[model samples]
Target: MSNTQKINSTITHASINKCAIPYIRYKLVKKPPEKYIKSLQLDLFSQFVTNDKSEVSNTVEIWESIPKYFLTPAQVKKLRTDTGHADPYEWNYSEKGGNFTVRIQPALIKQGNNKYQAFFPGITEELVEEALKKILTIQNHGIHDVNKVETWVRFSLRMVLKELASRGRDRNINQIKHAIEVMSSCVITLSKEKKEIWKGSILQDLVTVGREEYLADTDAQHIGRLPLFISHAINQLEYRQFNYDRLMSCDEQLTRLIYKKLINRYRHANLINNYHFMYSDLKSTGLLQQNREIDNRKKVLSALNELKEKNIIANYETDERKESRAITDVKYIIYPSNEFISEQKAANKRNSDSDKHSIDPNLISVNKS
Candidate 1:
């Protein structure tokens, strides 16, 4: 069978009876109930920053200490041995950003007395990952507290900042604030089959500014709440856990984002050692700015090389089609890493324990037949 046929056949034969484990339980915090959790009636605008000197210092300290515990071999082993009960639901639902495209060009947008700037961020990967995590966090909460269709959630600003790798630098908080503002203001035009399906922004409102005196440098520590529209999209998100440890090993920002994007696109499928993507699509989604195609191609090649060197991925080949003495199309063939396999093994073991001999829902299982 051809590659396309094989992919289609695999997808058709796939029967997922449970959702993939969300996060490594060993890696997550086991915190108690919060007065300000996901709530519809919660005043997100009231979630503000503080003006205390110690708050800023503490935030900085947390940010600095956060990366010390990325995905580790022990953590992977722990997740593999974990036998938590996962909901028996396939993660085949459509992802929000799957078919959409964002032109990371910087531009200013106006919204009723607020002028927001939308730009391609330097920390694009971090923001994207945090956004996905937030979606999961809120949706998981919605499953219990409220309906998951479009529920508003109140999340602590410090929590999100830490997840976003906030270094408590003077500029880190502002950077995150601007990132959210850009997401809220940027225009998203969704299309299918070369036709426009919907046009709107990803975020409905800005972070609620609270009146807390957390730090001297920062005046108001803002708590975040998702608007219904954004939550609606997130509610429909179906995703797999990528190798966070291997991903964090890469020091480059652009490389990390591209790698995550690749995983997000292909993780739903049962890809063993190989995956491919069109050059144009990679350039459109992976590259930061809408720059020259050749330059973008170079950057993509460089990033992929870096990943290969770091052993995140291996054995990658690119197909460059030259027409009229110009490169027209490119196809990338890359293999999964050893770390990726370890993660799949963990998922498979968990599935066996939870659903009693069911197939892995993440579609990342090894074909051990």
Candidate 2:
């Protein structure tokens, strides 16, 4: 059967919104070009293809590949706008069918003689996300030498700022700076096992060596050192690659968080076409918060609609079952977008090929008997 026919059959029984689904009609390449095949063969055999850490690639770098737990659900929370300081909070939960418990605890970091207290003073999704994003850039590009005991990465501050506050022209420079400061200042312990075997901060040190010039277009370079634990974690976990452009285009923070959570949740289950999210599931992500349940529900729906309009997902089908004149146990069918599927497929293919080659370095020859 053709790809189009398979997709049609999948959607037919699902009862999805026809209008919002983008055209997924892609013609199959029956005979790939000789050059393309040769490149594929090279990719299959070559140990090295491209480095993410090189200066050239870092300029336009977007997609960040890091440990899933860093940005996954329950990592971040909604903060009140007027709050002066972020009160320390603890998160302990299990994900992916309760495979293992994930825990986050706010703690202090010791550097040399001085000790710094880590707090989320004005922590926002974008802020913590920026720090992770930059670190992900470093990890993805092989810019930092992992073999070294301490893997420190330095990157363009202005470039990151531009990407973080891409929604606005002026850029939220102050906000980004503060978030990085708070995140870098303190240490957070992440443990997965019941015995608390592993623990460390995502970042060890964040320093600005160059003085900031107010009028300068490009600010001084900023350096960040990742803890060995965090570096190892990034290398260990499987990462999902999505369209960074599409993700950033949606200005709403909540929507972006939802998108990421969905991506992380379904990173491995590609065959699972539909994801049914409950009301509590949505609220847990810190995407929606209000005094009343009704208000919060409205916000969740609004955010989902925004994602739908932006084509972040193919479409969302709402299942609002009324109980006591109030919507309870609201469920949603989140259809994966074609664009997202294609990107993930390509990323998985590349990763699988890389893993295959990495498995047996001596078996390089492809014998055609």
* TM-score of each predicted structure versus truth: 0.52, 0.60
Give the Å shift of residue 20 in candidate 2.
Answer: 43
RMSD of 2: 14.7
Q: Which ten residues in a row have the lowest lDDT in candidate 1?
A: 1-10
TM-score: model 2 vs. ground truth? 0.60
Model 1 bad stretches (over 4 Å):
1-148, 151-153, 166-171, 193-196, 205-207, 210-237, 248-254, 265-273, 286-292, 347-369
Per-prediction count of colliding residue pairs?
A: 17, 3
How many clashing residue pairs, candidate 1?
Answer: 17
Candidate 1 local lDDT, 118-158, one digit each (tens): 24323542444344344334333222122322333334445
lDDT of 2 by residue, 137-204 (tens): 54322233322223344555566576555434234665555555555554343333343322344444
Best by TM-score: 2
Clash count (model 2, backbone only): 3
RMSD of 1: 16.5
For model 2, name the residue pairs that clash. Answer: 52-141, 53-141, 118-186
